[model samples]
Target: MKYDFDTIIPRRGTNSYKWDTPEEENVLPMWVADMDFHTAPAIVEALQERVAHGIFGYTKVPETYYDAVVRWFGNRHHWQINPRWIIYTSGVVPALSAVIKALTDSGDKVIVQTPAYNCFFSSIRNNGCELSANNLIYRGGRYTIDFDDLEAKAADPKVKILLLCNPHNPVGRVWTPEELRHIGDICLRNGVFVVADEIHCELTYGRHDYTPFASLSERFQQNSVTCVSPSKAFNLAGLQIANIIAADDEVRRRIDRAININEVCDVNPFGVIATMAAYNEGGEWLDALRKYLWENYEYLCHFFTERLPQYHVLPLEGTYLVWIDCRASGIGSDATTLRLQEEQKLMVNSGTIYGPGGEGFIRLNIACPRKLLADGLERITHILSKN
Candidate 1:
């Protein structure tokens, strides 16, 4: 089926975060991670079929749901996921909190690379764990992890878990194999567990291959818990379902206990159907979406290179979001975002919000119609030119 990624869909008044510019200000809401594109037709059909049954009572995920997930990882990424290792949660963020609570006691240090998913800090703190920062460095419009800092942090006895973003968010980096190996080795050596968030694993573009940290080595598997969901890949965040896959039996048991204490049983019925449909039948659509997103990335890259030289767009390897360096223009991400909002009438997220070292960079969500993308760039161009 042909996906209409070209048409601009009106998403306002649906309580969409993307369309929401301000508490009251009307600006194009492209700041959030959710795609403007609709979910795949197969997923919708499956949900409709399930809803037609007219039973919305307490439900359990059947074997087929787990099988679909396994097949998806196996076929697309060449990663084998055991059906038994999967634990369902409402969302990955919620699951992160649960895992922190499950794995560590209060005052234990949980390491997270900053300029990461903002909620990670809250999740760590909410679990009563002390948050430790391993900030990524920004150079030439792209971000890279400081392994020395990370290694030192990991080696610390107080630091318990590293919440790693495989294909990292805000600043897109599909971490290389060597990097993953080194990190995994460090974690294993230090007896630190790594909670790898591979949620954006499927959205990678070009030659970048996302290797699940747990799947790398036996030691890594023993020391890692990989979190994944169809939410980011299949545009089902609203349905709120994610899986925590722990390859180790002990870790799986602990996570299961966490789920029980948190009462995470009975995932959204619609989410189950949507997830199964996505994993089982939405491969072609995903491939096409990746191509579309890659094109959007390229279009934005070329546009900035030619028309807006001062604003350097980092080479995006994955995700629909692009990290832009507004520093060269003598404006920080805060000023850039404010100017875009109050002056140019556009909505974009300030990089500083992502965390430390995120200053002077802004993240723009390019997951929209080409026309909208073009319009946004043009508006930005005009705003910059006038300045």
Candidate 2:
């Protein structure tokens, strides 16, 4: 079935976090990670059927929900998930916080790849954990993990958790199995538990494939906690559902307690229905969506190559977020974001929010219709051309 990714659905009046956040009219919001395209028809139909029931009550998370998750991962990613090992949560962010709370005490350190998803920082901070940056090396317009630096950080006794982002956001490199094995080995040797955030596992493009950190081996599985969801891939962020998979029973129990204490244990009914629908029937739609997103990325790359060659557009191996090196604009990242918002009515994220190594960079979301993406690129050109 052909998915309609070309239509520009009006979202401004609907209280969308991405669309309605900007006060000015004609503001193109290419910032937030959520896609502008509609979710799969299966998800919409499943949701509609539930809405027709009209009884919104506390959700019990039926076995079918677990079956859907287990089947999806087993079939799609070749990662067999036991239904007994699954712990449903409201979102990946909350799952990370709960896992941190369960595994570490206050003041213990959590290591994150620099220029990471900004929420990882907040999750660590909220759990009373200090953040240790194992910054990714930026060279030749690509990002690679600094393994020696990661090893040094992990060797610190205070560092209890390494928050690993597979198919890393903002930077956009999908870690290969070899890199992941090396990382797993270092964390294991250092007694640092791995918290793998694999939410973007399904969104890789061309030659780059996402490797589930825990799926590499039994030893890695025992030492890791993986948080996954259909939210990012299925455009279900608003549904607010995610899962934590732990092969170790004790680890799962402790994290479950933390989840209850943190008060994020409850999930909305829509999230459950949408997740099952997405996993079981949304594959075709997701593939189409990925193709559209890849095209958008190529178009953006071409645009930058032709009209804005000074600004470097980094290669994106996974996820729809594109990282651009904007140092040539002769302005800091924060200033660039402000100028884009105020002058051109375009909204994009400053690289600084993602932490160290993010300076003088900007992250753009290309998960929208081609026309809208073109408009945003033109808006960016209007502002950066002055430089």
Candidate 3:
């Protein structure tokens, strides 16, 4: 417990979109994907040491950076990553855009699951690709991929890529091994390249295991690209450093070239330093953070179940975000952002913004102090009762 996650660090006036909002009254911002906790101390020390060196000039990524990344996956996930197969990117979203640009032609079709991260759609469109969404089947108190529909879309000649959000956002389903295999088979048979956006890969919980899409099979690995980072797990989104693991040499070169074209050929020098430090030393902090987030989630679930039974928190096995089905609240409490900001004095993500399947749903970021969480929920209950 060297790093305390319970303290709420002030982020206002820091150009922090997560905490910046025009609230005439007090507001609790549980919106945005960023965490309230400070990053690992090891990461801070690494970056500060870099800053102390004083010369902020161009950086040629050292072999030490790559070695740190290789060692991380090798030790924790048991996924052997070759340093050569790794391509550095400024961030995961930008990396997604680059992959879409590199692997397919303009106007080619790309598939993504809806109630998904909104960035994948824009990344696809930004690359001039026609984006297609296969909304997940919300059955049996959990989310499942629509494989029959997925294969049908992949069967189309125009379809060239499938963008996957593993440990999926909004719904929070960690696609199991069997699911990954089915998805890999569909993409492979249909001449579609798989781009797995596993940025949330390390934050999973329960018995779920994450299989890197590229690590599924030889052909799948050859035709796929995996985008991952320590941003989510380590709360280092500001670092803007992510790795694009490409098993195929040619695909690696194409993705690397596209990243170069985007003017982020080299990321923040400190970002690289912090990334290496994180993968090498932040494991214990990440593990601790997961336990805290899970507890926070349980508290939120219990609060809603007893005090606000009109609403329901979606079953989550991953991510610090808790998706709430406020359809039963009947007060349109799911305006969620509106209700949270105006009535409850809290700020949360509105589901409708995530695309079609998001309506009637709201995403609450639970990566904060328990005191803050309890206060936010208390305010919510008071508001609901008045309504």
Error of 1 at 51 (Å): 2.0
| Candidate with the larger lDDT of 1 and 2 | 2
TM-score for model 1? 0.96
lDDT (10s digit) by residue, model 3, range 103-222? 888989999888889888789888899978888887756788899999899999999998899979878888888999999998888888889999988888878777677666788888
Model 2, span 1-387: residue lDDT tens: 378999999999888999999987799999999999899999999999999999999999999999999999899889988899999999999999999999999999999999999999999999899999999999888899999999999999999999999989989999999999999999999999999999999999998978889999999999999999999999999999999999999999999999999999999999999999999999999989888999999999999999999999999999999999999999889999999999999999999999999999999999999999999999999888888
lDDT of 1 by residue, 174-290 (tens): 998888998888788788899998899999977888888877877888888988999998899999899998888988888888877887755889989999999888999999999
Better by lDDT, candidate 3 or 1 = 1
State which candidate has the highest lDDT: 2
- What is candidate 3's TM-score against the reference? 0.95
User: What are the TM-scores, per candidate, against the unseen true structure?
Assistant: 0.96, 0.99, 0.95
* Local error of candidate 1 at residue 334 (angstroms): 1.7
Among these predictions, the greatest TM-score belongs to: 2
Candidate order by decreasing lDDT: 2, 1, 3
The parts of candidate 3 lying over 4 Å away from their true place are 23-25, 331-334, 383-387
State the weakest 10-residue window (summed lDDT) of model 2: 1-10
Indicate whether candidate 1 or candidate 2 has the larger TM-score: 2
lDDT of each: 0.85, 0.95, 0.84
